[model samples]
Target: MDKGMFWAVLAALLVFSLIVATVGGVRDAIVGYVMQTSLQHAQRDMAAAAVRQRAEAARQRAQEAARQREALQARTLAPDQQCVSGTVVTVRSNDASQLIRGGAPVRCSGRLAEVPLR
Candidate 1:
């Protein structure tokens, strides 16, 4: 083999090794960037989930408050309704979710109250 060709081949091999080393370094940097991005996304997702959970809790509390308000309003007779004795009083509401006290017709002021469907 010619000395010139031999030196040329050795130089090519050395150049390839340097390129391989640089490529390895670049690959490591890319892997680190991907891992960092993934971690940030995970943290963001957890924070979003926490916010959603808190919103759901607040909504449940609001619903419970509304239900309590409805119950309180239903128990008390309206100013217009004056229960008359010896007469079947059929109390009606637009919502149809009236709170009738007892199974037996509940007497609001004097007369009996109709049984609640609920």
Candidate 2:
């Protein structure tokens, strides 16, 4: 081939290779960006799911505690006759003086009336 034609062919081949490389690089960059965005969305979704699970657990615990309180209240309000014989232990000096004025070793007996649940 003549020197002029060979040089022209070489320059053309160089330009073609550069174009291909540039296109490949751009494609790689776009793919990387898309993958990064997908990962971020997945992490956010996982965090949201964790928060929802924690809230549900807390709600369940609160409901269980409320049920326990209600059961205790029901037991307290049950209709049962009983006699309680015990000394009223004073908490402080003033309370002791009041108990002394009323009298010591007080005995009480009563039946709790049944309460209707609303």
Candidate 3:
């Protein structure tokens, strides 16, 4: 009777250990899946932020271009014809590029012709 009892107890203990191991493995898998999903979400958010930053920069560049065009038009329409005949102006812009922004000046050969006074 004593031997039978010992065998029964050992079998029960083995079955319980197997159940616990399976539960532990399932828990670990769930944790890994959650972490992967979170990382992917973070990457997507970073990409979207970069795109928005580029778009904002583009909008600012367009505004600056408009302002420069207006200034050029006003200068060209001045009554003094000699002021625009061979004017050289330096155009500076943030979007002009790294090569042009660092103390590099582009020589524009266009003249602001004077408009006739009404």
Pairs with steric clashes in candidate 1: 106-113
Local error of candidate 2 at residue 87 (angstroms): 19
lDDT of 1 by residue, 1-118 (tens): 8999999999999999999999999999999999999999999999999999999999999999999776656554554444656333455564333333445445554422342222
Answer with 1 or 2, whichever has the higher lDDT. 1
For each predicted model, how many residue pairs clash, with residues at least 3 apart or on different chains? 1, 0, 0
TM-score of each: 0.59, 0.64, 0.62
Rate residue 11 of model 3 by lDDT: 96
Model 3 C-alpha lDDT per residue in residues 10-106, reported as the tens digit of each score: 9999999999999999999999999999999999999999999999999999999998777777545222222222333333443222112235422
In model 1, which range of ten residues has the least summed lDDT? 109-118
CA-RMSD of model 1: 8.0
For candidate 2, what is the TM-score? 0.64
What lDDT score belongs to each candidate, Candidate 1 first?
A: 0.68, 0.61, 0.61
RMSD of each: 8.0, 10.7, 12.6
lDDT (tens digit, per residue) of candidate 2 on 1-118:
9999999999999999999999999999999999999999999999999999999999999999999777656434223223233322234434432122234443322322133122
